[model samples]
Target chain A: MLLSHPTIGRLVLSAAVTCGLAVPSYAEDILIGVATAQTGGLAPYDQPSLAGFRMAIDELNAKGGLGGKYTAKLAIKDTRTDTAATITAVQELVDAGASIILTPCDADATIAAGQITVAKRIPTLTFCGTAPVLATAVGDNLFGTYPGDNLQATVIADHAYAKGFRKAYLLVSPDSSYTAQLPEYFAEVFKKKGGTILGTGSFTMGQPDFSAIVTAIKALPEQPDLIMTAAYEPDFPAFIQQLRAAGVTTTVYGADAIGTGTVQGLGKLVDGTVYSAAGYPTPGGALEAFNKRFETTTGHAAESAYEANGYEIGLILDAAVKAAGSTDPVKLRDAIAGLDKLPIVTGTITYAGTNGMPVRAVSLIEYKDGKPVFIATQTPAAADVPAPAH
Target chain B: MLLQQVINAISLGGIYALLALGLAIVFSITGLINFAHGELMTLSGYALLAALMMGMPLLPAAVTAVAAGALAAVAMERVAFRPMRGASVTSLLLTSFAVSNLLKVVFQNAISARGKPIAMPDWMAGVVPIGSFTIGVGPLMSIAVSALALLGLELFLRRTVMGAAMRAAAQDFNTLRLVGISANRVIAVAFLLSGVLAGIASLLWIAQRASVDPMMGFVPVLKAFIATVIGGLGSLSGAVAGGMLLGVMEVALQALLPPSLAPYRDALVLSGIIVVLLVRPNGLIPAVDTARS
Candidate 1:
């Protein structure tokens, strides 16, 4: 086709000459791709991840790039936190010669990117893609750096059990599958652990009034020991505040969504609330280092799970690229699957074979007088919890 | 459970009523729906939030929010609705929609882009227990505010000369023109009144969810439109009644339905509307006979 078209032929001849002229000075660089939420409701997740990824890449380059032969060149695209945008971002990265792709933000978006990566046989690592369905959905190519939601639920239940909360009041939103599943998962385990569910109340999303639900909880003959809620950050604070206002002083516990900036966004309202988290932000270790480097580069502190996941996934991608030695997708996939003990700021990340799901320790953190304090770390007995019944 | 559902419905209905009242006032006099009504509410909520963030007192913050909403309404009249006076209804509707979109984009950029929960004041954060049921202060505030706004509006229409003139203009602009009252002034008053209603509604809305987003106005606007249609197009009393009825029906249906069928709540509401329209044809209350033919 190039030879048949005169314009193409002339352009190809000129390109070949130009390449030949510059070939001696050209140096090879490993291209790493990032597909993350840059806009939408998930921008809080994606923006920080992008910052963390860049900081990690800059640090690696300062230490003399991956494999000592190639400097890492980061290619980032805004997924807009939508499924279609995520797929497009991955395809664009693959088209632009990315060796490996990084997934950040929502589980659905990450899973969508995983499908593309699997088709292209590229090694893809995600920071916050924790929906259990993604494991069976994307199979081999998808790997999560953060522990899945199952671990989060287990950690919360165990923490409650350890705290001697025998009866728990559960508040779940039926609108969100994420919020709905957490309570369902916790109920099963909490029951197994011998905790009685005192009361269960349902609320639809966007209903600001929780008086009926709160009133219901408050009327329980013997007040529950704890309030286990599965709700988004926006709803979580309001729910917590209302619960406090209703004179139900039962200690409140929440799922991973509460650990996000949405909780921090609550400021003083977030005090005394305990929530499950993947990692902690504190004094000078890996996380602190990551935070310092991230803040230096991005002008903001890494305050949420998405940022931690993104920073850690970048480290994972760097390791896989170093192990693979080349940008070949097949080699990178094999290298990632074979990763035995990759160290991340969050934890010691290890992939569970072709499932590509990370099995890491989950942390329980509480907001004490307006600051997040790490409470305990719990490891799920089983890394892969079966999907809950519909 | 049924009583709780009833309360839920009332709170929701009250919000819908306020939204409808805001939209209906504009429609009644100006004959334009002001598609930006939802944004006006959202902008007010954000203004209150911005004030709170700026360390202003809550009362001042709330006042600023209403003032901001009113100012925005005035701006809308000056920049969008006023210019297109006497144009086709379709053109006016399109202009309102365009203004809504522009405001949404601008607000998203200026504030947190997507929806972020606006924090409630410490005073508005809890529930008041009444007998067996509990209700959030936010919902109570919503119901109280809507009732007061509607009552004040009804009195305004009855007692004030401007309000009387507005009713006259809405009933027959041509006749009012012959009487030497400027049609523009009456229309502008309508917009201002609607803006105040929207501003008040914004406070109630943010109080309920404790959050505000750019597109948050879409659902409220849709509910308001449905309420205004179900109630009569030009009747304020009908709009209030329709909003409360819709809210109560929605919450009651939600309480009655099984978990598996909960997602179909909006569908069930629409189905009920279809049945009602089929029976009434001209809404639950007909427009005042004196207003038109």
Candidate 2:
């Protein structure tokens, strides 16, 4: 009101005109609240994924803000891999008026943040919440960017069955929700496909000795057709080394955790190791282009599967916002739920009837010469798997 | 299979034994747990990695790693712990923790909080078969190195004046100081020996795991601490025995537990430890003359 006085209003108008002539002003930024672990134990996974998300955001903004009206700005909050920190970070972002919230890769770590977004009625997308029930369990506002764990497990089971491996031995790290769930889903799908599970073993995280597991395998009446396990590095490589050292030549299969620089460091030991993870880009595709850009930007080629997941989440959010035709959270959430065949850098994500699970292609890759060799892309049929046990 | 598993047990036991001995040495002299002892191992591993990356030969790199550990231990003594020499036990214990966390944060910032891969020589990671059994060379080396280091430590303690001084200090530091022995030198030597053991242990550890992280020292240190407690604090031989027993128990349980019950093997081991403690409140080998006024 003070500025609206006749003489003052004229002076302010002249000053605004002068400033506007010197520098163009951008419209208000559409805020994206990204809650991820940038430090602590999870940083190895979260940092790379966050870089991918940043790349995607940069790419989107380069094309002139979302709908040419609002620039998509990130309000990144580091959860430090702590539950309390995740809650506080998400709350701060929500209070700061984030239109949608993005969460970390692990379902367990993101649960608190998901609760906040749900309570606030803000649409939330997790970059790599592979657990089957993360979406339904979290809330109606939660959407998973990656395919459910059941899908990847089913993908591995189907591929193994196709390879004529009907008898399998399973090993799991009962250390985290991610590792523990792999064997369950794999057993479900493999048995449904008429494969028999010969034996199973479990261990804690950072339990370096796999000698007992190897001994157990050797005790079997006959060698199993396949050896399957859910593991991450540095345990993964050590386990493989010990298994090979024990002269157990049976073929091995693992989850996406095997697809990391850690396991790849195993050199020839990694050869012929088959694993299922989220797909990367096809040649000359958007993901391929993004992968190149990512290498240049981060000074390292995308090293983990979650990196792709991180990039895919941003593209997914953009598509949902465009489809909703408004920034309203309810309409955006509805549109996100209804998204079908949305082309992403990783693959097409369809969210129509998946109970908030994204239906996307899971990659079947074999290790050859210390790098993943693409075998084939697979979309597991819903009939070939059992429903998640909530 | 039984013989092979025994080999595994010995291999695992050797690491715990060495780590426990290191912690025990420092604890015996200072009555401080020296939780930061693990960071000495971590620093040595990182130092070795850096030296190797800089094209240093394997032998010299190993030496440099050990030296790095010793130096870090001495540095910690001078910079963090020395000033608190006459402080209360509670403060000293808390200082060790603060030092441990501070070192971890420094490592996390300077290097990485996550595991960084270290290339092992083919010989280091190779396996050798003796008749019907195969033993990992890395594990074999751990056993041999621990045995040799233990022998050396034993000889030093019994035969050398400095080692005798350490023993004297462990029993009664104030008395040793009253006799005109340098308390500062005795403490520094104790730290030096502990760091050297940690450095050697670090090499063996990285060989098996093939990677090192800030938290890499955590599990080993935790196991070592448990071993020290089980063996009897302030008793070096007890620490070694405790570590070996724990290692054997863990490996044997892993091997013998039925497939259906294998997942609970660690819990079972912990239960066994609890039972043992219940039976013997002072641990398996109570330190001599620990009934201090």
Clashing pairs in 1: A208-B208, B9-B248, B117-B211, B118-B210, B118-B211
Worst 10 residues of 2 chain B by lDDT: B284-293
lDDT for each residue of candidate 2 in B1-293, tens digit (9 for 90 to 100): 78778878988888899999999998888888888988999999999989998999988999999999999999999999999998877898899999988888788767875677776776765668889766667667778988998999999999999999998888888898999999889989899989999999998887777777776777888889989888888889989988998899999998877767877888998888888789876678877747520
Candidate 2 RMSD computed on C-alpha atoms after optimal superposition onto the true structure: 7.1
DockQ for model 2 equals: 0.42
Q: What pairs collide in candidate 2?
A: none
TM-score: model 1 vs. ground truth: 0.85
Retained native contacts per candidate, as fractions? 0.18, 0.38
Q: With candidate 2 superimposed using the best TM-score fit, by how many Å does residue A222's alpha carbon deviate from the native?
A: 1.6
Steric collisions counted per model = 5, 0
Q: Which candidate number would show the highest TM-score if scored against the true structure?
A: 2
RMSD of each: 6.9, 7.1
Q: Which candidate is the best by DockQ?
A: 2
